[model samples]
Target: MAPAKATNVVRLLLGSTALWLSQLSAGTVAASKSVTAHLAAKWPETPLLLEASEFMAEESNEKFWQFLETVQELAIYKQTESDYSYYNLILKKAGQFLDNLHINLLKFAFSIRAYSPAIQMFQQIAADEPPPDGCNAFVVIHKKHTCKINEIKKLLKKAASRTRPYLFKGDHKFPTNKENLPVVILYAEMGTRTFSAFHKVLSEKAQNEEILYVLRHYIQKPSSRKMYLSGYGVELAIKSTEYKALDDTQVKTVTNTTVEDETETNEVQGFLFGKLKEIYSDLRDNLTAFQKYLTESNKQMTPLKVWELQDLSFQAASQIMSTPVYDAIKLMKDISQNFPIKARSLTRIAVNQHMREEIKENQKYIPEFLPR
Candidate 1:
């Protein structure tokens, strides 16, 4: 079907359902019967409008599940052309049914790129008026103050010259506006070599403005750390030796490490571990909240389906947390070797135990409906 026709069908269905539900809510028996008959005759195969009316007539968990299932099925069928209004309607109704469901639905809507409905839903839930059109908000990643503006501009010019072949072909100057300034700095910091990795993913015809937007979004969200670790991390990890290996006398003289040095090493190790634990705790909390939302709507989801979504979230969190976990392990190992701490073995064991507990906690977020 054409996109317009499909949209019309959805609008008509929603309008009919709303009218029927409103009448049912007011306890107008005649009006309710009249709307139901009209919707039944209009959409014979799909009785969703009438079902929604019945759900409004007597709200219950079972009825709510039926309504959600019907909406889910409709959404699946309407996935073509990326039309998401149907899903948005389901989310809107889901919000009305439960607060958590509403928030999750908003998340789901954004995931599917249903920006319009998601924005509308957010305004309604937030109880705030909408911002004027063309309004924009952004997050900035602070940069070190060591480099002067002119030096940074020169670096950006060099970076742009190198990146132009891969990103855009023609000559173009970076925008001077505040909105795009951070993006330019990020691109400059990324350099040509690192930005080349994105060449395959980015289209040849993509404009500089589009690239700027993409970079801004990436810097703000940074959903996956693997890309950075694999690309930029590897580049930065290459060691540059300033001098030859130390002689025996130099090594022997450095061996006279102090008690204060050892204490400082322990403190650094403790700080690294503490930060790792905090990241783990946040991942656990997010998973737990999502799991609770899933469990509450268990009647509407299959075990396999639940596990699929749960696994996706787990993998994303794990990917993001992987860098910190590695850093902590490396810090512990480095500190253990440098200091004469007798608790090195015990600390290793404790770190392993903490990681095990974190992984176990992550597993708890998967709904019990999935296989054990």
Candidate 2:
């Protein structure tokens, strides 16, 4: 009787293990196919504005400004309507202008790879450059400017305080205060610099996750691709050693090792290990590919890297925010504060609020201009 029962138990365990393994393989295969499809679709269709340098070579300043205004309007419309088609048109036009010399040259100056050409293209369209006096309506980076860093900091703090409760509650209200406008404007105009500053904090030994949380609140409604691409640049700076501390390698390895035994515990561990190994492998491959991409692409890749990081973060945030969870709110808040805007900080804040609402209401995800 005992031998018969033992045999039965072993059979059951083996059956269960087989089932689990099948599911794991199926899942892995599906995920890979999905990622491949996404890349194939996005890469082929995306306007390679950086490489197509001649598109906007001789566009007049007035025309450039008109294009930029249209881009801004399209971005705003996309935000309001959550429409993918309009955004796609915006990208087509924006890509053309960004490839222009005046617009894209600044991209080379900054270590940023992806959006410099876009910025330079916009610059060329403006009749004027960054105010020679270095005093914009938002931020004062000039030696002649008399605004105190403390004052700017105070304004940021106030804006953050005003927006925090609403960000979590899905009841966002835009700031109308005159002083607060500068803070928002600064964020819009210097988004890259703000982004760098935000990550610089994350890169610090004593990084404050709360600050990142604040900035995220304002930028949360933007497409997921933007966030995903944004973080890739800083991720390059994070060491494997630091990541290893965040991961449990020994347990993962043990789980990955195939279990010859026909038992429940062994089956569970093996299943877990397989999943972890797959994740580890994918990340390793991504990093390897990224390095290769950088070496081959050279300076042009800088803007691409920045955009990639933003897209990564954007994708992650979109999922989190869709759930309307507390972590999502915290993340949104942090993003809002972290990435300083060069032009439209208030707009970003408004967009974040709108996204939060859509997420809470289970709105459908809109396809972005780049089709990611």
Candidate 3:
């Protein structure tokens, strides 16, 4: 009788628990539905964009941007009356808030890989008439210019080499097409220095004199320019396939090493360190030469500070050297007596560690670029 009473008590508890869970689940579903309905009413296009954001959260920024751009382009093509306003509002808010939603929208819209959408977004953002001198506006304009150049190059490949350039007859008809107009505005607003380097490239490849003239006119246009400009040339230089090749080689060599063969492991480590040392030496030499040239010629190009150069050099070296360097340093510390060149290796390790810290410190000072 006592056992039966306990079982009845257990059944009652289980029934109550099940009922509570059912109520909780129902409440959650109702809350979610209500939120969705609210979002739909407040921003008619936001629900789909939010859904896209969730789907793309784990993907690369480029892929996410591509997807968002595709959605935007499709909306435009479909002539959805409300979508243009909706998208503009979203972009405006993004620029204003600079929050997760803003970042995600940009990551989905302005990736270097998604050229067309990047351009479109740039144009849209530019059209919002954000202060021309504002940092965010400058970044968007610069990216727009890059996209325009890339797009023009792509189109030029399909166009006849000798095709006549569109003529400008002073009737508000600049040679600038819909695609190139943003670039023109960027140059007009940002000044000649923004595109001075690319002018030569444009001149060399432009299909005709008229095209070249139009490009030159925009690129050389003078304006009240912002004082500071972000330099991406070094970053671009280090992002080549060559760095990836080195990384792959380093990985393979390390992975193929067996713990049983201490000599082979040491040999691999030695080889890697040798390569790293060579790269570091080359970079130091190049930096010295560049500094010398800058001082001698008094070129208008902004000179990199010594620490900046060191940071860049360390970053470049780390691409191929970080893993092997780390392992070698660890091994030496573990068995200092057995390690060859113990003192020198320790010094190198210290330097590398310090440089790593400096790089982290410098990142805080660096301006936030869109892709970052």
Candidate 4:
């Protein structure tokens, strides 16, 4: 490890070891299968892991807002009996967008070569320290504790989490009768987690005598934010996924006296796409509910939160409150009230603009236009 990374390891080891051990001790059977990470986020209710979720959770959710932005107006011209027609159209298009993103970015989870940063980190740190007197092909994170790494998964976890070890054994049978096969499992968030949570389940499954070697990884957030999507509360869930299994060619037993670094060249990208699909589905459900709410004229709806009200939603609400139908002056006055805050934010963006910025002011990537 580099000096900076070494320093980070030193700090974490010195400062966080106690905290880590305490959390490990505190988890009950069910709670043990879950880890929690608070990555610059605050959720009001359930701390479900999409139930065994991960990041890009925020980044994926942000697409909901972006999807709203691209459409200039709703498609229906006040003639549809089905309130969900517009919502369904948006959902369908959003699904297309999600698919496009996946094909372009996230297909790597199934790639032949494995790439999991968290497991690498865990193993690296373990190598730096200790792994017991003799053990084949597995790092001992803690020598004091028992490691249960085989068995049927009835199962899954939550934690301050990490890198994707989205690997599988390719020749999986329907009965999945492959005995003693090593399985790589990863649980990560944008913040902390523990591989130990998986122990109880794996140990229980092992006792049943149907077993495979398990390589479990629990990770915290990475330095990079590339995987996640962020917008508002509108998009807030990660779809769960299990990656493709490794074929015989991809898995070769190695001895200590060999240089295997040359084969570690392939890169995996966008293992985070399923998380986006989960978020979009969640958003679609919300829009479906919103459409149903619109269908009823006498329904007294709950007041919308500021986070729930987007610029367009605010515009629509303003239009509905107009003195006369489609009054021009009222619309102008309603929208103009936002000028003060928008101007301040725009000024900040302007001040931060570099003389030689990579993306130009009118670039299609963002296509942001400031009001003069």
Q: Which lDDT tens digits does candidate 3 get at residues 1-372?
A: 999999999999999999999999999998886311111111111122333333343344444433433343332222444855655554443343355775675656432222232222323444454434422212122223333445555444434433333432311122322333222222221112334334434434433432322321121111233222122132222334553335877776676443223322332312343344357765644543443343333323344545444444354334335447646665544444432222222223323677677777988877665466
lDDT of 4 by residue, 1-372 (tens): 699999999998977888877777776554757544332322111111111111122235344233433332333221353545543443444454466564333233312112233234443444443443333223222122222344123122211132322333321111234644333232212112123344334434444544332433222222233222132234347678978776654354342112222111111121122243356766644543343343232133344445434343333333334324545555456336754332222221212234224334435555355454
How far residue 282's Cα lies from its native spot in candidate 2, in Å, is 64
- lDDT tens per residue, model 1, 193-303: 223333222212133333332221111111231211111112224466788766888665465233223322232222333344356766644543443343334324223
Using alpha carbons, what is the TM-score of model 1? 0.17
Alpha-carbon RMSD to native, per candidate: 35.0, 35.6, 26.3, 37.2
Our model 4 lands, by Cα RMSD against the true structure, at 37.2
* Candidate 1, residue 269: how far the Cα is off, in Å: 35
Q: If both were scored by TM-score, which would come out higher, candidate 3 or candidate 4?
A: 3
User: Once superposed on the true structure, which residue ranges of model 4 sit more than 4 Å away at CA?
Assistant: 1-100, 107-119, 137-372
List candidate 3 stretches off by more than 4 Å. 35-372
Q: What TM-score would every model get versus the actual structure? A: 0.17, 0.21, 0.18, 0.16
Looking at candidate 1, what is the lDDT of residue 318? 35
Off by over 4 Å in 1: 1-64, 69-73, 76-86, 99-101, 104-248, 256-372
In Å, residue 75's CA in model 1 sits off its true spot by: 3.7
